[model samples]
Structures are given as structure tokens and as C-alpha cells.
Target: MKPHRYEEFRDLHRAGAPLLLPNAWDHASAAALATAGFRAVGTTSLGVAAAAGLPDGTGATRAETVRLARGLSRLDALVSVDIEGGFSECPEEVAALAAELADAGIVGVNIEDGRPDGTLRDLSHQCEILRAVRESVAGGLFVNARTDTYWLPGAGQAPETGERLDAYRRAGADGVFVPGLRDLRIISELTSGLTDTPLNTLHAPEGPSVPELAEAGVRRVSCGSLLFRAALGAAVAAARSLSVSADIPSYAETQALAGAFA
Candidate 1:
């Protein structure tokens, strides 16, 4: 692979088989997924921020996010990073970061409209960021435009979601993503309405499953931060259980379990 190919990503999306993207927070997590046969891996903004001791969705971890992308760039997996709101409102600044990610061998990124302050950026502003990244990245990197309309509760969701996707597509996004859309009817409608554009949807326990989304014409299924969060919860539960039970994973045992990564 040339380490960058939007067409490869586009072809995968057009396959309609549900491209499953596992969001990895670190080198081991990403390398493990690559070794386990995932064709592509994405970095969860939540995971990246939390691991770096920063609040996610706040665009406060740009340096850490870029650093992690640089690390994952060394692996063989196709890489796409979740750059929370492009880490800045300035379109060109986001473009510079996208160029850095591309130089590090990442093939794609998810830039959302939601800001850390819990308010969504304006459509024009979001589109400007998308266009800047597209123009800066030399057409080889996939830019997944993510709208917060579906994720955040508010008025004018349905129309706003569609409008944002349209603007983002016009701004040169390779795919449009709605992270919290779970209704089958809405998913079908979105896919039908945007027939020429690829759709990416986030999947969690309560969301539509991969099979359902594939049937609904969703091209990419992103795990976001669910896997990482689950791992955290499991570790906490295991430790709590050990405090009251005889079962325990010692340091050596934990190392043994992690030997595959080693």
C-alpha cells in the first residue's frame, strides 16, 4: 500500500458490506487490531483525549492526538483519526493538522461540527474546515464530515442533519457521518437521500448493529470509544471483584495476557 488512498477507502465503502472501524487509543490497541485482520483502524477522540489526561470533545488534545497518530502511522493498518472539531475553528489551522496527519501516513480523519462548549459550529464554518482540509491534503486523504445534529438533542434535527451533510459533501467530504442516528427509518432515508455520498454511522450497544446498518446502506460502522470504554469498565469491575473474591489477575498474569502485543 502507498499508505494513503481515498479511493481504496471509497471502494471499501461502496462494497456495502459494512466497513467495521475499531477506534484504537494507543499503539498496542491499533497494532492488535491490524494484526487481528481489520482492514482499517480509527482513533477515537475520546480515547485519545482521556489517555492523555485531557477532556475529550474539547479540542484540548491536538498535540496528543497528533502524537498518537504519528505512532499509529508506523503500523500497517489504514489509519483515520477522530479530530474533534479539527482542534480549532480556523479552517487553515485544521488543514495544517490534517497535512501533518497525512505526512504521518494517516489516510483519513473525522471532523465533527460539535464544539467542546456543547454548541455546534455553523454550517458554513464546518464546511470551510472541510474544504480547507480537502484542499490541503492533496485529495488522497478521506475526510468524514460528522454532524452533531443527530447526536445532540435539539430542535430542527432532521432537516439540519440533512443540510449539514449536503454542505459537507459539497465542501468535498468523502463521507458524511451521523454518530447518534439509530432509527432504521431515518438511516434508510438518509442513505436514500444521499445516494451518491457514502455514509458513516457510529455503533454502540443501543445503536443499530452492523448487519442492520449494512442493510440500511451505511458504508462505514465506527465503534468510536465504546470498545475503549468497555475495556475501562471491565478493568474496574475485575479489580473490584478481586477485592472481594479470590480471583485476581496479577501483574505477571496481566503481562501474560498482553504477551500477544509484545
Candidate 2:
């Protein structure tokens, strides 16, 4: 059973046929997204933390994060929990958390090496965390190791990115994610460095299209926090529009929309 689900998640990352992951912040959003036809749903750390009025990527949302993952696991879509920095620096603790998530039926997890102070965790330490997680879950979880070199200031170029990803893949990461990296040249350079390890990139509206990324060798395109933000924007816009027009949505219309989740 574990292998079956794990393979299903892993197979979604195909070179030239990337998985377009839509991130959700809560059960309602995740359910709505699954109802909308997404096979998998990733939780955005930013969306989850912000919705709960906590700081994201700062080890403040551990309980909330776990609870959300547990809830989402029961949904129709495969759930991937974004555990910022594994919610601890200790590799053993991170592995324990991953074990719990695996027991909860989560198929994937996104663990990053970026510190809240805008620095990357040392390559060796991050690799240890990945290795421990890989050992703990025993191939049941799709560990998407994330490197934030491009997302941080004063970070080095492809040489450093490739070095870290190479170590991460060697450390047993099922896939590698580089958020904030949009350059086709850099992306191509980085992907070329990996040997069969799926390259995951954050989807950028102004960046390369899916086909372009496929050509560049990206196997997974994640919409991290974009959908959550868009939902917030739509809600605010709808309220403002109603105020400006002095109009209230009809009871029938409200019920119809609400019933989608029910």
C-alpha cells in the first residue's frame, strides 16, 4: 500500500509532463480544489500560517500544520504537507514528524533548507535531515527537498544550486524544488545536473510556460500560495463590489456556492 501511493506520487513528476500543483490553505479550499479536478493538493506554508495569523516558515505553525495535514488526508486528493524547515533543525525530530505525517496518510512533504533569516542551511546539515526522513518513512513519503538559493539574497549561482541539489538527491530526496528560480538558462543548468531526480519549480505567471519548463527539464510546477492569495483577492473584491453596488447576493446564489463544499 505504501509503495503504491508513493509510486503514484512519484510518477506524477514526469520530465516534459510536469504535475501542476495547486496549493490550498484549508479544508474548504482543498476540497474545492479537488472538486475542481486537481489530483493532488499541496498546502502553502504561507497560506496556512497567514490564515491562522502566525508567522510562516518560522517554526510557529507546527501544530496547525500537522492538524491541517491530518484533515486534508481524508480528502479525495493526495495531500502534500509543506513543513517549513521540518519545524525543527534536528534531523531526528524532523524524521519523527515525517513518520507522523506518513501515518496520517500524507503522500508527500516539502522540506526546505532556507532559514527564516534568509540563509540556507549548511549543505551537510540539510542532507542529514533529508537522509533521516528518507530512512524514517522508508519510501512511503515523497520527500520534495527544497533549496532556496535563488530565493535568498546574495546567494550564489548555478554552481552552488547544483552542488546542493546533487547532495540532496544523493541524500534520498524523491524530488528537488527550487523556488524563486525563473531563469531558463539557470533552470536548464540545474536540471541537467540531476540524474533522474525530478526537478520541481515554483510556477511563475511571468515565467516560462509548462511546455517551456518541460523543455528545460522541470517535472513539477507548483503554484505555491498563488491560489490562496487569489482566493483572498477574489473574496475582498466581491465584498467591495457588493458594497459599491449596494447589492446583496441572492440567498439562492449564496446557498448554491456554499453547497458545493457541503
**Leading candidate by TM-score:** 2
- The digit string of per-residue lDDT tens for model 2 on 1-262 reads 2667788888999888999999999887887778779988899999999999998889999999999898887786788999999999999999999999998889999999999988899999999999999999987999999999888898875678999999999999999999989999888988887879999999988988989999999999999999888878877997877543344445664444434534
lDDT of 1 by residue, 133-211 (tens): 9899867788899998877657357878888888899999989999888888888888998867889999979777788
> All candidates' TM-scores?
0.90, 0.92
Candidate 2 worst ten-residue window by lDDT:
253-262
Off by over 4 Å in 1: 1-4, 243-262
Error of 1 at 78 (Å): 0.2
C-alpha root-mean-square deviation, candidate 2 = 3.1
Per-candidate local distance difference test: 0.83, 0.89
